[model samples]
Target: MTITRRDFLNGTALTIAAGLAPTSVLRAAEAQGPAYPPALTGLRGNHPGTFTLAHSLAREGAKYPGVLARESYDLVVVGGGIGGLAAAWFYQQRFGGNARILILDNHDDFGGHAKRNEFTVRGRTLVTYGGSAEMPPSANDNAAVRALLAGLDLAPRIQARPGDDYARRGLGRAVFFDAEHFGRDQWLAGDPFAALVDARNAGVRPAPEDLGAFLNAAPLPPADRQALQRLAQGETDYLSGMAGEARARYAQSTRYAVFLREKAGLGLPGLRFLRSRSQDAYALDADGITVAQAISIGLPAGAGMAAPAIDPRLGKSPASRLWFPDGNATLARALASKLVPGVAAAQGQEIVGARFDYSKLDREGNPVRIRLNSTAIAIEPDVRITRVTYGWQGNLQRVEAAHVVVAGYDMMVPFILPSLPVPAKAALRACVKAPLVYTKVALDNWRAFDALKTWRIHAPTMAYSDLWLESAPGGKDDPVVLHMLYVPTVPDSGMSARERFRAGRAFLLGTPFEVLERDIRAQLDRMLAAGGFKSARDIQGITVNRWAHGYSYMPSGLAPDDANLQVALEQAGRGVGNIRIAGADTAGSPSVTAAIEQSMRAVGSLNPKT
Candidate 1:
């Protein structure tokens, strides 16, 4: 009996309602002596309950029938992602811990994208972020985010020693050219960040000439190789006809693909090589993104020329030095623990090792209650109090609150609170998130990676853009998880950025898990065959945390008057009748820093005396 991704997502909702621990279920399955690649192991984010609830609220378009129970609170927050969790913490900060609050999230887990993917293989425990991995250093400057971490005693920083150690183990960067793009499966040992020399470790610099050799060795025809050679050199003035200011303007205004085709003469093959780079960073394709944005992130021939400040080798200081083992999930965990004491150990960043008592999350008489697998269906703001109707345990439940923070996905806000003003709704709709998929593939051993002489591989023409070996907390051999990132996008010749995102979201949600798994297995085998990697033989388990609607929208630099656009969004989210809007949407960016800021805004909108 094979369970599809959709089936598995739906199945988990039932399991959550039954109060069954997913860990116990996994242990029970492991007790059966591991069925090889294992049964039903894909699509792990936006769990079944969350998916169904959002779908029901959106597509169903009907009022939730017959309230199961009625409750009241001083504050009711919708969605339990980082933003909502922070909102709960902020309420505690502003109104004291005595404030009665309830956080309703559709997912079985409360961390939202801050969820975790834990696996135990051969008496070894391997943990990876299910979603919302890594915190930017700028987050440290965010007093709220920093204060929360401080309260939890979590000092977020990457253990560069482990990563450096891993790099020394016959490991480096590699690029994969799928047959669709390059006419054959080819892996080249080279650093993709060759142009931004400083981005690589201090001693791990690959010279331009060395990278040229790697490109020349690609299984491309002579002409293609020559074109690639020129691209690698970065000395070619490909904009020959358009010189000086014209060239500068062309570089800034022209789409990278056009610059590549018309100016650089990269042809179809050369362009394909650079296509994945854009999608991996922003969800935009070559056609959709401007050459300016492309250069800012580093790509094409003149990327470093335009953006010297981004060059890591030039001693350019990064925004911050804050990132955790499980990304921002650690922050989410910290916030949850603060809101619900004893839910997680009060220990520092090592909270990953602490087991959360979910049963205690929504215990009676607690000032703060986080109810998992509960979805907010509707919110009605009145003069005195806001009424929120949510679904929990397959029943519609109503909760009234003096203040309601609708801090879920921005797009869902209009649907959940239909009476919102038209302009605000339009502004909310514009906050569409970029869909992303992050997969963790556990392997029995990592000898294949060593044999291949690469730790990371980027596939421009495949479903997955890049994959690399993820390090566990403690350095050990034999068992490891290969983390792969997939941004579901295919260039639509005639679609706006938002339209393309919608199409990509549909494509991602509609696609089955088996297809994704097959691609993962096949791509791994093709890339690592030289090192003796057979997917079925060495693959232990795969957890695909599919966030069909991922990163929050931040207006493109090319977009007109970024300040005004944000002002419009902020005005739109000002909330009607105490139904204050919050989350990354109101922040006009998907960053955790913005989420925390919006959380403060949402709580601040109410009377401080309340």
Candidate 2:
């Protein structure tokens, strides 16, 4: 018999009550009192609240095909993206031939937004479009992600460079920071602890510090100033070190940023600043908790942290985390490679993945087998799926004993279930997610102006949101620059700052060319005139892709912001069954961790781990 959500949790509770386990984690949880989840509440800042949480994190393009027939198997993975691929790959590795897996997707390829656009820009070849922009990471805390990299054997190939290195190459050493608000290097390089010590030693003093007096001074609201002052002094570690808001912020920030930037961005330089210094799911969503939760669960598992500014980077904040090469893209690619051979090699425009093999099974008594381009229509009795009538595609498909592991955008959840029972529908529907938008940009310039080595996130001069993306990551002589942006979308008429992004069309782009050709020409007039290529005319080809819901949101909420979402996933089989979920959106942690988590979650549906 299939285990329901209630059954699963109750079983867990019983298992704990039996005291057969060897760990005291539960007792510790109880003794520590009510703890904060640190995934969301840990990081409190203004953000775009557009993403919804009712489903998994993956996109089922608008042209999704309708289920044309009925067929059953060990698994029926609706989406063929990274999350699903990860689950399938891991299952294959751990269980081998023990489990049969079948992956179904509406798109022509398997990688989803990870598609690449290669073309000659100013006569240079580039991995132009779609997918990650950079490897936004800090240090050690990325165990699961690194483990995946180790499995790939591509860990050493990772290229690590500083943000400024990219900027200097592009700007001719003219890299600039805000003139006011914060000091030139204080925001990125200052150490608050060191400064404090120096200031206290009778006659000694630390020079070249502006954020100090300004941030700590009574210039703005008390709360803002308090955090700002701590940040200015580099005492942020105190928050997390002693089980305070800072630690919670650090965990939440690291988790959210690593997930979005490293795992999701995967070599992408998007998301100018993460909300907290956190590095896990708790950073994304605080769930419902109080000051006590903020202290206990939010902080690290050790002695209280030292004073701020003492090698702040080394103080255990989340932003200072390290990363692996290829980020999570390598993992996605590896997973995709396992599911579909041709799919792995063809992640770009030239048509990846194997050609459509089998047809959908349109009638009963048909042998279950693999089929391509088959859309899910609905699920009846919360178990049986019924394919919808579409433009006569062909015979129904069924893969005997095929198992599925889906990991993609959560919004596709509704469609994943071919049909749904009224009760399960309400529960799944209640797991609402915040709205989100993922946008990326790639540009090739005729002339090679410096500043490629240094990375920066300064907003455009005007009319748009402030520059929220990290600096570009290329050397001045790199010949091309790629930039990605994380723009949040607000709904209807709202007074929120995100209203600006909502005004524009949503695009999950990885284009090969920047539309601001005129701007490029102007910036490189001298270089273009000297380098042979004059204007946009000399530029070559370009490609781009867009997703309305590229990434999911990590709003502040109950324990582990995604707790409710996790609960919602239990009803995967109750929908129309047409929605196929995947992506970081559906992830409980919303990072590589969550991506990994949801994939396993999907697997438990088809084949229990134990």
Candidate 3:
């Protein structure tokens, strides 16, 4: 089971033509843990069930034989997130009318975490307020976003903002806390030497203060340095870096894990934090270090018979440099308005284009269809899916898709994709820092708020999450809105529907009344303050944008190595011939950029007619 890069390449070449040649090397991989690259293996699984459902639904067909008749479509999209929407958009934009795409979301609307805020103000009949916000400044560089802009003819509108390594590579949130309270900026702007002296005097040792302190403490073996460089030269040559079984693990891993197993290659002071139970969530913040120190950390550690070939940093690292526009939601609102006018229709009476049933809406007015109502039920093989099936309200509905585009952790995918046949890259399944949830608060002082407006800022909380959306053109009086995320309760894992609803309500009704509210208010208070309007009655209305669960979990050190994994993930991207996946799970880590990239990739390759 000691797989070398040579063996993988041989297997890859052989597997590529399994439809034409015998993949002996591919067989060796199959015998182990990795899910056989479908393009290489012909083993399809599923013991035919009683076929009861088919028969039962067929009974309806007998009564009305043509009732649930299957309809042929150029594409049958299984999931409807930004990725799917982008795919549909790209397909039409690239190959137009010929590809009759049918996007199916168990939910009513699209845009995964891109759900929004709805507000109402008294003495003001118009709702000139609402918008989507809180995104990585790197989105401007996102291939998918660029493709989308090109598709929509707004590429020029995307102002060219230079980005930090982290921003361009699309990793890490530009995490900012109340600098005045946390002294973050004082620490950031103050000389690194001065801050280092302060922390050192305060007895904060072993904590990374400067490049030298970090290097001095890192556990890199001098002998391994040469080999580590070799790995960085080419993933194909990286295995030579690890001593023993470590080299073998790289050959069999699901691309991401090898990074966990191989980072020992860095012969400097690089540390890994165990953020989750999975073996893969280890991270290395190698900024301010030499290029060599950064590259040394990219090799895979042996995980049984698996190893992924990865170069520590593929694009760039997250540094002090970053980028953002007037507000990050510019594209989200611009596109959401174009795609789901139903979102605008739900904005009271001002916007009048598409109409949606308000009663069928979530408390936030986001249509019911887009919400993931149930806890993850099952993930199966063949198509490797997370299946959340329901018979609630006397309706049979299911959210079935190949990959979950899990931006949180690998374990999340397993929780939903119970039957996932791929190597349970447990290391890759772990989540990073708790995702920050955002929402906006509005104060109505008996004034007519603009019902439709542009983006706004909460200035106090440094919460740029608030914005004004124009559901319908020419409507004035946008409502007062507060866009925010910074939820104190976004636990490591996901929550059930019951948990989501209660948590959401606590954020709304409990504010100024709830305990967490006091803590948050203290922070926002530092940024903004208004006391005259006291009671909730004095307040006409409020809107919140809650990503109880935010997009995929992305941290440092999550680039794939083995080419085979890329192949497995790539194959998983396609859907029912025309149907395909569009999210962070494919392409690379969880980010709007990757989501857009994968969507465009799938869109270009789609033969919806098939």
Candidate 4:
């Protein structure tokens, strides 16, 4: 069965069209009523109409000439993502609760990458994370993040109950070897990585008996199968002589793919099988991550070598992470509610089901206002006040602020604030973001997964590298949301990490939604057909959260360790006069804690007392 664009658009025609249609048409569409963004389906994240002005100004140096209105605020924040919202929150704490703050974001929704996707099927409301899913345990340890969570009265809820209906039904993990990569369509009953990681973390080597049957059933060559069996059995020491810090350094510095081939004696097919193993976490392939970096993030390590100690600051396992049904988007909503009380009245877990009043977000006379569908194009600093120019509703509007906090992507800062020093701009340009897609597909039922006894499947070579069911208390007959991940990487292309990221961004932007939708349907059909799955019938709706610029680029062993580049990155976050930069990029990490901490630091820099 073939699904069409019309099938996905339950009632989101206006939202989907708003991005593609002309300004005149868009204006007419907005005249109907305020848009409730969470409920809108189809293509999301970096949706159309969001980045047109940004591209125009950055790429073509196009100027917006019209100045429709001029307003003033105590603080102005560019980019209304988590960082921007936190900046506003911190400004209130520092400068008092009455500080007038204006937050401008290009997307119709706030939260930046922390987006929420909602669907209604058979009178049941299903929620899924479109982007920025979890708050790691490390985030809770931060004083600022803890304070923010407390202020919002947000606490983690038990994600899975004692008797999860899906679990009780015996669903587990599996792997799908597609015909294109494995020479035949094959579905294995267990995930080798999951079993191996669990075994390694528990200080036990995985026995061949545990994975032998699964590997033998896989459509892999004999050499590749033997290599995997050896990896599981923990028979060979990849780093035979090295130990302690020396071994750690070597693992941290060497590429994982290289380690597999040269050190572990794995063949080309085995390397391809593991290419996308790291995509879900780092949005990079084996080539982009080092062996130590892979192990730190809980990827399966070679069994013979002692597992490296995991850095507490880095990502932990999913069991330790906490999130609401809509993921960190609930945190965004909570932040918004705290800023503008009219947005939402719910607290804690109730916020998960809260229906934010979009109309109340930007009401006049509010201490804090979040203005959506407004893209900041220029920041002209003056002696007393800085003027921020933005495009809103096909018109250029100007706002003046005593202090300006730029909380958008670091790479785009150079384009927005061209007056920065040469080195500072160069530093900002070096912060390249990885591109990824989080597609949330609403299915009428999860019978296919139930029948297959697998709720998650890792498809390394497919258009989407991973697919899993959301952790909700749903039986096989109930409607459920399936989350799919796609990280665009051009491996072995001889391009640097930054170059590869740019190419991936282009691919995400240039590809049409229809093409993406087709691939999603085809892949799901192929992987689930044996379990009596029919994509066109089972799929109720699809929302592709395409983030051309997704994760902040954190330096890894793949890149040359250059001190000058590190110095430049540090200088980039330093404020010039009244302008400050804050975001996950500023901290060189993609966690929510980084976003909040950087915002707090940016706000603290503006303290008059210091």
Candidate 5:
């Protein structure tokens, strides 16, 4: 079911010798190039060896032929993401400071989604967050998240300030409608949150008339234009039949797409336009989310309706003042320093600029060891200990731990530990994550963005949903990194949540790097042509951080309740023998805070029979 690079190369040799190879493959074979570095420019996620081990377990119910080596530890964590790292840290704090702990990850590097993508262009160092962009101040209120920040000596107030030119150079918000999706590719400049009347709102400087002009000029049918205009002007009576309270309740319980079609009387074009806005946060279309969920995330308030009021407690909470160039990778690095002393430079200083030596991660005799490029294939929990079998360095290895935490994808739990009860397996299987691709592009200079007079552009129909200049503590014309966020949702599939996630994951992994690079360049060329930007000319380097299993599935909208989902999840997470669960998936919310909270719970639930 899976073909790896090794397999492909082996087949390539036979085909070329038999004179049956394709021209492209032959040329690639004959091309004398630098040893191909898959890490440098292409194919970043569901990485070749990473998922093949999991697939062997899931698809074929495989068991390793023999264990080449065996080791024992006090605690073993099966992921190196924020959640897994924090679990080790919490275990150290709670029960044993000197416990022999080991963290294994499938990636060559740690900090799974909290990845720091680095680039050196024009002799200047630049970094961008590949995933996990920002941590809201509200999230830090959780004890676990706050404790982790405190451990890193990152006070909530010590933060990066945007350069003076940021406000001046930044494009507040703009929408681009592509010719394929709409009738034509049209770029319009406007603020998404400008129309609503609210005291808390920081209204756009553009006058109401200017905002109206942007909508009126959209290349839509007469009826669509009229409907948009009415919504924009705040003069629509779409909810005429219901009282104010009833209307509000309907909005909360019903999907926005349904509300638009049934109540707002908008056609497909209008629906598409409104739904595009949701891509900014949920990576979902209007039908995939409820109006309440949309409003909660500040997507859009319905036209002619007053914006919903924020919870007073949340409104009054402190805003996040700390932002590293690499987002929360700083937190992960700080935690790594605590777990393995010499792996990362000690924190309390400017942790963002700290140096990490990956080679020192698994030094001999260290109380806490981090083994990279190790994939957990199976986990079996016994009365006295939990045994984990993993593939490492071309061989199957085994490790026994008094307590084991499976901290990666929740759905894979059933596959990893086949003995899990039926209800527990079903509950773990129900949790599916959204697929995301975050591409960091190096540019010689940001002259194109300046020419376009916008720092960010939202494109729903393009391969990338949105493109924005990576925020740094510098000026606009400086060599900068542009971030393109792509959500490859299989739109109009009419598939269930699990099916859609599987399809999206398959598409994300199967699509090669060359295809992705071509698509990204094409999108950039199409969007920036008006500003005299050329992709090949301006673009210097590209790093695609493909995350097939990104963003945990959180229940929202008018979705029907799976009556037993929560109960089953709770039961599954209650440590089976010496094995437990950790991750954002266990928290049922996709966030760093949730990951930390779940880690704490997982560690606390560990009742080691040993």
Candidate 6:
């Protein structure tokens, strides 16, 4: 039976007042203080009241008559995401600091998917990322990305923290077998899947001896256990008879699951165990990933056959990547600070800890204003100026700009700009986003994790596939934040990647907060019960950052590359008169660097002679 919110609250020893709504819990705490977006826990990311107008315009064909144009700007950027923010910065740089620019976003907070979640437990403030978490080495390689980082006084590279804390505490990676799939609750101490990826990193190494014991302890049938043991041992070359080029071709064309079943000899149980391994990177299961793609990402294929090396362009070392306490939200905050002077008052890493003054974001006389909770409904381009109409407050507001940058979702662009060509609209509609959830649970203490002797747990069949502590607790009583990931992909469903993404998106938006909360609590309680973890007593706060339209979809390697689709994506990003498109989706890459690069390209396209 589905657990209700009342049942959950009644069962737990929650510190918050009874009957207080989850959405208002944080707001009530900040009644006497300045409103802070990061600290407002529960139902964030694509929060309610943020998407109503957009949904109405897209789904119901609702029209908003343009009100009298109340404001004019040199540039009006739709969507206050990284792309839009970067576009504003680039425009100001190109047109001088005096250029009047405005950025409009539907969400109450800026940064879009680059969201920051903050919590206060036991009088201590903790920071965690709700979305857009890492700056990989490839991001720094882009000159535009590097320039943006340099302007913010931020370093592209961060020194990896010395030593593995989990190892030091006698804890390691683990796998939790849920009753739904395994028929019983079982926790295995060592995870072979994680070790496969971790082995590629130079910073830490897993002991080879643990693999045998871990695999044997798994609740798999004897045949499945034997198959997994063979794959882990990496002694047999599944593609032994083929030449190098033929092997490469086969790997690219064949699915990873197909390879395991046909060549590696894995049965149903083994296939299920390995399904969600690829979800963290591609948001797809083993059935969706190509054998070549799987090997390149450090998934075990056949160690006997020279495994295809990780793409050098993507960067192989984990240490080369940089991250802030609140993920790439640091980059967003840095951009906002540069664009709007008083949004944040710190520099360098201090920016991560700085509390943003939301009031200063859209001041009367500011050259660059970021107006949040303003949803753009229409964008009509004229010979000179473009008329932009947005739903704000209780009425439709109009604004005119010399040039408009369409930096929001490519899919929504077709709805907003109905004047676009049929082909362009089709291309825009094709950019389906992968649906996922990044949940942050503020805990009273992480003694349970220490007791379990596992900092990370991978549960293939559970609601959340992956869960890990943001960092090791300093003491048994120290409060901590646990991060969880859920990707709603229907693998082996005979649907195309885009179709699966759309299905996942629908499922995410349809599921309520209470259901998500219940699943999280139940999963945690089941996984950590042996460690003396009780969700009611330990979980202090939960911020469910549901990205129904999450990661910008890219080809998942299950299907052959389509040239027509590539051309369509390119055409989608092309400028139409005074309107220029810029976003990760438009750029055809789901990275901060690509978004910034697209923004720069879009800005450069505007008024070239100037």
Instruction: Judging by TM-score against the true structure, name the best candidate.
Output: 4
What would you estimate as the lDDT of candidate 3?
0.33
lDDT, ranked from best to worst: 4, 6, 1, 5, 2, 3
List all candidate RMSDs to the true structure: 6.8, 16.1, 17.7, 5.3, 6.7, 6.4
The window of 10 residues in a row where model 1 has the poorest summed lDDT is 29-38
Let me know the TM-score candidate 2 reaches against the reference structure.
0.52
Best by lDDT: 4
lDDT of all predictions? 0.68, 0.33, 0.33, 0.78, 0.68, 0.77
Clashes in model 5: which pairs? 171-455
Residue-pair clashes per prediction, in order, are 5, 140, 58, 0, 1, 0
Off by over 4 Å in 5: 1-41, 66-69, 157-165, 170-172, 192-208, 233-237, 243-249, 301-322, 472-476, 561-564, 608-610
By summed lDDT, which 10 consecutive residues of candidate 5 come out lowest?
29-38
Q: How many angstroms is residue 325 displaced in model 1 relative to the true structure, after the best TM-score fit?
A: 1.6
Residues 1-610, model 5: lDDT tens digits: 1223333334323211122222222222221111212225555544545665665566545555545337888999999988999999988877778999989988766777787777777788777677775665566578887787776677654445332345565545567887776899998765442333222233333244664566677766778766655555555667776788887777767777777777667787777777655554565667666666655544444444555433221211123333666776777777888788876565755667776777778877898988877778788877787788876665667988888988888988888788888878888888887777888898877776777677778775567876877664455556788888887655543334555556556667667788889988988888888888898888888989888888776654354654556566778887577788888777666677778888888998877434
- Encode model 1's per-residue lDDT on 514-586: one tens digit a residue: 8878888987888889888899999988988888778777665344444366777888778887778998877
- Over all chains combined, what TM-score does candidate 1 have? 0.86
Error of 4 at 462 (Å): 0.9
Which 10 successive residues of model 3 have the least lDDT summed? 38-47
lDDT per residue for candidate 6 within 472-579, as digits (tens), equals 448658888888989876655555677666667656666789988998998898889999999999999999999877777665445554436557766767768878
Ranking by TM-score: 4, 6, 5, 1, 2, 3
Where's the lowest-lDDT run of ten residues in candidate 2? 37-46
* Candidate 1 runs further than 4 Å off: 1-41, 66-69, 161-163, 192-206, 222-224, 236-253, 300-305, 308-322, 472-477, 492-494, 557-564
Judged by lDDT against the true structure, how good is candidate 1?
0.68
Write the number of the candidate with greater lDDT, choosing between 2 and 4: 4
